[model samples]
Structure formats: C-alpha cells, structure tokens
Target: MGQQEKVATSLAGAVSERVSASLTPVDEELERRYPGDPGTRQPVHTVYVPGEQFAADTIRSWGDRALAALDEHAPDAASFAAVLGLADDLAEPVYTRVRAKLEREPIEDLRVDFEDGYGGRTDADEDTHAARAARLIAETYAHGAAGNTAPYLGIRMKCMEAAVRDRGIRTLDVFLSGLMEAGGLPDGLVLTLPKVTYPQQVTAMVRLLEEFERARGLAPGRIGFEIQIETSQSILAADGTATVARMIDAAEGRATGLHYGTFDYSACLGVSAAYQASDHPAADHAKAIMQVAAAGTGVRVSDGSTNVLPVGPTAKVHDAWRLHYGLTRRALARAYYQGWDMHPGHIPTRYAAVFAFYREGFEQAAARLAAYANRTTGDIADEPATAKALAGYLLRGLDCGALDTAEVTRLTGLTLAGLQTYAGPRRGDLTPSAK
Candidate 1:
C-alpha cells in the first residue's frame, strides 16, 4: 500500500485498541442495564388543573369545552383554517377532524397540580383537597375515566423543600391511601415530584414510593415518578457540571421522565417575567441540558408551556391562537414532542401544529424509507441515522393517530409484516398496510 494508506490503517488500529482498552466492566454493566430505549408512551402535551377543580368528569368534558370556545371565538371553521394556513376548502373538514379527535380522546396527559396551581392553602384545607383528589381518582377509575383520560395520569406534589417536604409527603400519603381504599390504583398512575433541586430528593421520593407500595400490598416499583427540572440547581451543579445525570441515577429506575417548568426555570436563571417563555433561549438551554443528560438513559424529556394562553375577548382571540401555535411549533422543531397546555383554548392549535409538523415531511420521509426498505438506489440517499429517523417519524405519526397503517404502508411500500419485523414487536399495529 502507499505510505499514506499504510499510515492511516496504523492510526485506525491504534485508535481501536485505545477504545477497547478504555472499556470497563462498569461500562458494560451500564449498557446491559439500560439495554434498549425505555418503553414509555410519550403524550403530546399535558393539561394542568388545580387540585380543587379536578374531578372525574373534568377531563371528559375538556374537549367539548375547547370546541365551544373555538366556535365562540373563531366563529367558523374558516378562522381556524386561516390560523393553520390551510386552503379554505379544507377548513371545515380539518376542523371536524380535530374536534372529533379531541372529543374522542382529548387530553394525553393530565397533571392534577398541588404546587402552583393549587397554591398555598391552609394545612386543613390542603388535607381536604388531598382527600378530595384521592376520592376523585377512585371515582374516575370506577367511572371508567381512566380509559377516557390521557393514557398517562399523575399528580404533581409540591417541591420537596425543607419547609414543605413534610407537607408534600403528607399530601401524597393521604391521596394515595384514599384512592387505594376507595377502589384501587388505576393503570398508568404515576406521581410527579416537581421543582426537584437535589439528587437526594429523587432518591428520597423513590424510597417513599417503595414504602407506600409495600404498605398497600402493591408490587414493588409499581409506582413511577417524574422529576421536574425547574430550578437552576436541577440542571447544573455549583461546579458547572450537569446534575441531571446524578438525579436520574438517584431515581434508581423509577424516573420515567424529566419535565421543564418554563417560567420557574427561567425565573431561576434570573430572566424577567416578560422573557420567561417556552421558546426563550434560556428555556431552550435548560431543555438542551436535559436532553444531553437524559440521552439514551430512558428518561423522556418535555418542554415547558406557553403561558400567554389563548384566552381573551373575541377581538384578541386570533392573537392568542398565533402565540400558542408559534410556541407549539417551536417546541416540536426542537424535538420536544411533548409540552404543557394550560388553557382549553390551546387544544385546537396543539393538535394542528403537531399534525402539520408530521404531515409536512410525510411524503418525502415515506419515499426515502421505502427506498431504504427495498434496497433500491434513489435520488434520496438513506443512511442509518436517516432510516432510524424515518421510522421514528412514522411511529410518532401512528401513535398520535395522524397516520394509519394503510396510509403508511401505501406510501412506503412496506407491509405491516415488514414494519413489525424491522421495528420490533412493541410497535403494535404500526405496520404497513396488508397488500
């Protein structure tokens, strides 16, 4: 071989050996433990409600309420069509579709918040609210609200600060106990411990959950929790190193997700209230830190909400839609597939933005994926990364009900059988259409 080629080969061999020598048993164990990606259903957005207002039928009626708001504010389908930039002719059908989907399955994740939303009630009042929340959970399960509510339902306890830690624990204890006694824990039940500031808080929460499980006679680790990365301390250590890794490690496999609290996190960074938004650079930085720290650790990361909220007089309604749509689209672009939705008026734009984001790239992604699957050389080259992305895109579409198996198969030249084989069994019926 030429001298240059020989030198290149020698350098490659040296690098490979160095990499091999750097491997340790702990690294191998970590790989084995994490294994594949965490199997979790990521909802598009979570709806936050005050604990006092939470009830079994609250989520059930959200869709109708949202639709009514749309009708009153926008007046006609054409108004929403204008917001979405769709052709006038497609407006009514699109409106009908969005409304139907919302009615059939409105909220994807619901957070009954005791922190900010519920505010600081008196000790007796807080206890009363907790009991009411527990009873609501039981009634919801008995009334089949679990089936109708978002697939992931949980409560957000107050931050585990020194002054409020005991209060938070008490609320959780009372609520869980009441719910369990009334009926039973429903499927997809989780707890959200918010404004996490330290790794010890996470470990402590896990231990508390374990104790509760044992007391309730439930299986160990049956309860999972999510940590809210709100304050500045949660994302970065005093020494400037990322702290999310330590937080996840402390959870010991019960940390299902890491959620951003836009306003609180931004405020913690000293950003003025006017600038604390989901799309603000400060918020983006926090989310990036979270994504980096949680990468491949099976911890789903979510963005914060658009607090501008699509609620005002009729004259100001369009402006509200514009703001909400812009924020939602920005979150989706940043790869934060899930975010927070505060107002029912934000519902129409939420689904529209997600559907449009996926639909915009559908044709090209499908064609390239089909070419990759068929092993055909085409104008659009498919790399391993691109293939994975294409599969994920289609999977997200399917999961959100934006695309059906028949449509996916017809566009990609892949049958359901092929998708199942290629993507694995957990994909459910996300296969290509049967020929």
Candidate 2:
C-alpha cells in the first residue's frame, strides 16, 4: 500500500489499542435530558437560527411574544420569535433600544445567521444572491463584523412554490453548490435541507456533491450540510426515523448536523399550529431521533426554530415569554447539546444555555476523551468491535483536543523505546464513548 493508506491503517490500530474496557458511565440525568444514549461524541458547535421576519423596527427584532397558547388563544397560533442573536445591521430605532437593553451581551459561542433571500425575489439573482451571501459572510466573519462574534449564512429557500422560482426541486443541487462555490463557503453556512422525505433524496444529495467536488476541484466535503426534520415522516413515532437515520448514517463523514423543524414537524403532526414544539409529543419523538443519531455517530444535531412570535410591548406578555424562552432554552440546552432561534434576543439565551449545559460537563467529557486518546500501543479494547468506533474516536479527539503523544505515554505506560514496537506513533481522536 502507498504511504497515505499505510498511515490510515496505522491510525486505526493505535486507537483500537488504547480505549479502556472498564470505565464509569456518563450521568443518567444527562442521558435522560439529552437522549444522547451516553455515546454520541460529536464535538459541539453552537449556531443561531434566523428569524422568519426581521421587523423593520428593532423592538420587533429583539424578543417577540411566543406562539405558546393560553386558554384564550387558538392552538394553531404562530410562536413568538426567540431571537437567539439578532443581526448587527439593526434598524436605527430598534437598534438603539435593543443595544441599550442587551449591549455587551456575553455572546462568543453563538453564531449569528443572516437571511439570504427571504421573499420569492432574490436580492441579487437567486444564484447570484446566494453567492453574494457566501462572499459577504466570509468577509464579514473574517473581519469580526458581527460585533466580533462570527456571522453565519442560512439559506431559507423561497418556499417550495414561489415566483422567480428554482423551477424544479432538483435544481436545489445546482443552487446550493453554486452558492458554496461562489466564494469559498465558511464553516458557518448551515445548508438547512428543508422538507426532506426519502432516504434516496439524501443519498442523491451526497452523490451529486461528490461529483460536484471532483468537477470543481473543491476539496472533498469542505461544505457541511444539515437536514431539517420537517415532514410527517419525521414527526410520527410510528412513521419512524430509521430510514432517515440510516440516510444520515450513510452520509458518514458528510453531514454536519440534523435540526428539528419545530413548526413544520408540528404542522406535519396534528399538533396545534398556533404553538411551538418545545413540549409537544411530536417534537419529543423527533428529539429522540436526534439523540440516537448523535449517540455514537460524530454528527452534531440541533433543535429547530421557535417561529418568530411577537414578544410584544406589554411588560406582562414580554416578561412572561422571556421567562418562558429562558425555561425552554434551558430545556433544549439540557435535552440536546444545541437548538435554534428566530429573534436576536434568543442568542443570549442560546449562549447562556450552551455555557450552562457544557461549562461543567464538557470539562469532564473532555477529560474522559483525553483519557481515551492517551492509551498505549497494546491497549486493545472493544465495545461493539466495529471499525467505525475506532475511526470515530480519532475524529472526535482531533476536534476536541484530547489526543496527543504525552497522553498516549501516560495511558500506555510506555517509554520512547517501547513506542518503537508500534510501526509508528499514534494519531487521531476517537469518537462517542468508543461505541
């Protein structure tokens, strides 16, 4: 075999050797809360979902009333927009108040997303606008434009049927790739694959992109894709996510994340359209799939948007939903490692949720990962005895910084001379609890 193939094989062996058989289980409380099966090891990355409508006024942009229903309201009501983090390009009046109220918000971990082409009309040509968005995002993000925190681009398509359309659904392939290639796409683009149904649709996507990368000479898989679990197929417990999960699993190294389409998932089920999906049974079922997907796989999963309900001017309504958002944010924070937002107000909540969720727990997870990464040349261990687990560990460690030579020496109890017995030094991080 050539050198690269040899290197890969060597890595596989080293990781296979190091992980321990007997270890403490992760917290059950966390397991119940997150549905991660205590095995999914994907390194967490937080992102802010964009609001459906950015009100011209800043008041509307910050926090709006929730779609959560009261005895009086209809069940099909739209939710208040929980703005995770608003765009820096605030409307003058709205900006002043929102900035005054929420300035210097502790927001480093959150990624603020910009809406690309909302109304059916593309601000630039549909293709051109997408490209422009890619360019602008990279530029602005690099310069620390969105108040120093990175700004991402979310391409919310102009609905399935819109004017000045994409013509056919198949054209999404061209549209997305064009956008990513328009400028070098950033790590921040959440290519929200909305309204996904069949496994073939996803598989076809992976195949098409593989072909596109070859033709364009773009390095393989630089652009990561996220699937929005929206349709009835995703919401119904009986309908089953097994096919979709298999699709994501088949993606292997390609999919970056899975986001639950809260409103869409709600609508798909007979859940009242008026409210959000936080406590709904359908959303819970969807979250279960998310937990399973992330359990042993390295792919990250996210909860979906709290469709921009108006957190109105009334102190009673505003504070009530704000508190509700706070509670829901924490619930999602605990349930999954991540979630979505509609208004900019939601960013602080998301960020806080992240800090609360991981500040303490992540250190332990990081510590455990370090322990795994440091094992010696003879440290053969097995859970399921699969190649994927070993492969996963290497990738996870690489992302989370738990693997290095020193840790290897400590875990293996091997000296430099002893290391020579192995063909070469070990490398790569292991994945999700060595499953």
Q: Please report the candidate that would top lDDT against the real structure.
A: 1
What's the C-alpha lDDT at position 355 in model 1? 70
Superposition error at 185 for model 2 (Å): 3.4
TM-score, candidate 2, is 0.55
List, residue by residue over 286-363, the lDDT tens digit for candidate 1. Answer: 899998878777778888887776667865777887888788888888888898899888888888777767776778
User: Candidate 2: global Cα-lDDT?
Assistant: 0.44
**Model 2 lDDT tens row, 1-435:** 455543334366556545432221434434433332223333233344333332222222232221122211312112222232322322222223223223322122233223221434434344554444444445544554223333234444422324323432333444455555556555545555556666655665577667777866778875556666777664333554465576565564566677776777787677887665565767777778666756544456676656544345444444544553564545544455456555444443343333333323433433343334454232444322322333333333323322333543454444323432221223222221111
In order of listing, the candidates' clash counts read 1, 39
Which 10 residues in a row give candidate 1 its minimum summed lDDT? 426-435
